[model samples]
Target chain A: MPLYYEKKHQVQFYEVDITSQLTLSSLLNLVIAASGEHLEEIGVSSEELISRHLGWVVTQYHMSIKKMPEKGQTIYIKTAAMAYNRYFCYRSYWLYNEDHEELIEINSVWIMLDLNTRKMVPSDPEIMLKTGAEEIRRPQKFPRIKLPKEQLVADKSYFVEYFNIDENEHVSNAHYFDWMISSLPLSFIKSNHIKSLDIKYEHEILYHDSPKSYVHFNQENNRSYHKLANGNLTAAECVIQW
Target chain B: MPLYYEKKHQVQFYEVDITSQLTLSSLLNLVIAASGEHLEEIGVSSEELISRHLGWVVTQYHMSIKKMPEKGQTIYIKTAAMAYNRYFCYRSYWLYNEDHEELIEINSVWIMLDLNTRKMVPSDPEIMLKTGAEEIRRPQKFPRIKLPKEQLVADKSYFVEYFNIDENEHVSNAHYFDWMISSLPLSFIKSNHIKSLDIKYEHEILYHDSPKSYVHFNQENNRSYHKLANGNLTAAECVIQW
Candidate 1:
């Protein structure tokens, strides 16, 4: 049997941004939902993980966008677990339009965490076996996002509200993208399109924490570096290519 | 033939707030989506509206909530057009849990606008005939939400970003609710459940406008009145009951 899983979704009206294109944050939401469904199919559901005092946390994501599907379009998302090590699992995701044209490709790394200890833990052996996770090495290396060493071009604070937190009691990853992009001027976002993105989560921003985002743009390279900080500590960093 | 149109949806993880219950803003989104689907079934789709240079704008809403659904739960949303006059259309919506227990009841008024003139217009005769809309008066009169005349308990400004704008090039009504609720103390939202809400849209908040929300809470009546203002002009007013 094939190890990959697929799901079909119609882009809702609310998912589109002002440009009438699906927003980057909503796209990530779809990707995460697809991953959750895939895990459930492999008998590694969230409830099962919680029962074991474990939870899955995404550590890194590298994605390339060819085109953004518009509102009211039907898209297909496919994902699979490529490999698993002691403490981390590698997965791949692809989104395509109704015409079977590829729209985006994403690679993500997830670490299993012990809920009580809040430390990385080895994957359960049963999960690997059940999902038929093979040790296939990825052709392309994951991007290592670098933090900006220069002065900040834009900075803004985002108060963690009830809507931003998720089941894990932390700000959802999608909101990280939201805060990063929202820090830029509306004119910049309206004039440019995101070509690629690489992000790494260094730490978690808990509920009631007001995280601030600092951004630096390299106009020559059409790239932007972002650092999301909770007070003095950096919570996450991201690099975006326009 | 039944006048109501119903749709089934599973509450996604991203829809839930920190408390693991569906956020009130997401609930309104579901209701709007159901209404759109019902409109399409009766030959009045967004595309049709655009072709005729006409659009639907929400003018008022009064909603009563008994409970909120948890993530992963299946809920049914039903909506129907109740009546239409020269300048407004009345609609009703209900949300039900898996057991068929009603969770929410909403009544809304929509004004059809001439997209070119930006003025209120009469409903198309064919639309009324196709939907079999009848002039049935509501049992409970729609509340006239009063603007806060007292001291402001909380005030904050939100910049209209690309993600907040909708297909009509204006901030969607759902985002207004989001900003209003997000402005409240997280502690208050976590401890209290929303019992009812009455809101009126006095003006449209357009893109690139930074609107500020002013709130006044009356502890005795468990009511909070809010006014969303763009500079010196008020855009919308709402009264929330907890």
Candidate 2:
């Protein structure tokens, strides 16, 4: 069994939206931080991996929300590295209120990458052993995100700012959530809440890359589809159920 | 003497820059959040103040930094409402490392505004009394931010997005620091550290306002001047010593 790690966090004012509920992007950051701490506790920190020119790059995420945490709410974040294949690693994260009621559940897939070439590489056996993840022959299956039937409209563009770049020298994955949600109408955003989200990262976005967000909302299914791209190079695609 | 409040915080990855040091904007958010908690404890919380159709608005800030905290560092943030006159209130914030060594100091001026009218109003005696702040006849003084000696150039333009607006229904003041810093060259930002900063807010920027960041750098004084403007209207002006 993989080792489990948990930490308590208080949502700050800067992490919330106008309605006082935590933003999706901030929620992702909190979960990722918890995972980072978990790895560090297991003696397989990101910095140690970076020193060997090997880094973990997220490929996909599937999240379900019962309710978003609000400002000033103290919640517990729990994470565990469940299993790993030759090239892919699977992890799970959970957010719970003080009462121990689950608020959000997220499962993510990551791949080890050679930083020098930015190419996918096999997970090192020594590092994988440190995480206490079980070696699996088969990869975990996630729901596939279908492309929008209608042509998506490029509604907004975002310039990669200096602050957006993370220690990994790439735009943090959480920013993609912000870009996707910003493409929707303010009225719709204020009235609707996210039920579930599935996102897949295709190409990595770098500094100064001006990416445009393409969006399509289906009224019949109450679903929204989003694509972040720089010209023809798509960086990420996401589907949100409202 | 006014009541003071202090809290300890562990810097998280999201709060740091590429170099692992806390970003100036994040530092401001930490300080402001500390003040919010302090006011809440004093029985003059922002919610209570807003219910009466009144709100506290920042007018000016002067800050001096000895060093910026890094990721994984535990630091203490302390704040107090120093004094208040008829129309202006003074507050001070200090950030200290685990050893209690001072890292950053900020002095700010605020005004009570009638939310309905958006007009400046006198200090509410009952609320001010709750803060344990001494009423004074004279307003506290802050450094004057003079206009740039050279013609400022509009280096970058930023569109106010949905997330930029805070609960006050205006763009958060901390974001202005981001816009100003982003106006500088990445090379310069990476090489230099901020020594001091003085900023004065003239008007509030709202959603969808595409404001331009204008900057002027003086080599002799190692000072940079920044102005955020929406067409002919100026939003904020700042000077930073490196």
Please tell me which predicted candidate would have the highest lDDT against the true structure: 2
lDDT of 1 at A24: 82
Off by over 4 Å in 2: none
Candidate 1 residue spans exceeding 4 A from truth: A136-140, B136-140
TM-score of chain A, cand. 1? 0.94
Candidate 1 C-alpha lDDT tens digits along A1-242: 22899999989898887777889889999999998889898888989889989888888999999998888899999998888777778888999998899999998888889989989897776887777777544433687787666766547777776567877778887878878887787778877898999998888888779898899988889898998989888788899999
Candidate 2 chain A, run of 10 with poorest lDDT = A161-170
DockQ (C-alpha based) per candidate is: 0.67, 0.71
Model 2: per-residue lDDT, tens digit, B128-182? 7877889999877789899664679888998887778776557888888888888
TM-score of chain A of 2: 0.97
Q: Could you tell me every candidate's TM-score relative to the true structure?
A: 0.93, 0.97
Please, what are the lDDT tens digits per residue for candidate 1 over residues B108-208?
98888898998988777678777776744443369777755767654777877656778777888787877788778878887899899998887878877
Per-model TM-score of chain B = 0.94, 0.97
lDDT of each: 0.83, 0.89
Q: Which candidate leads in DockQ? A: 2
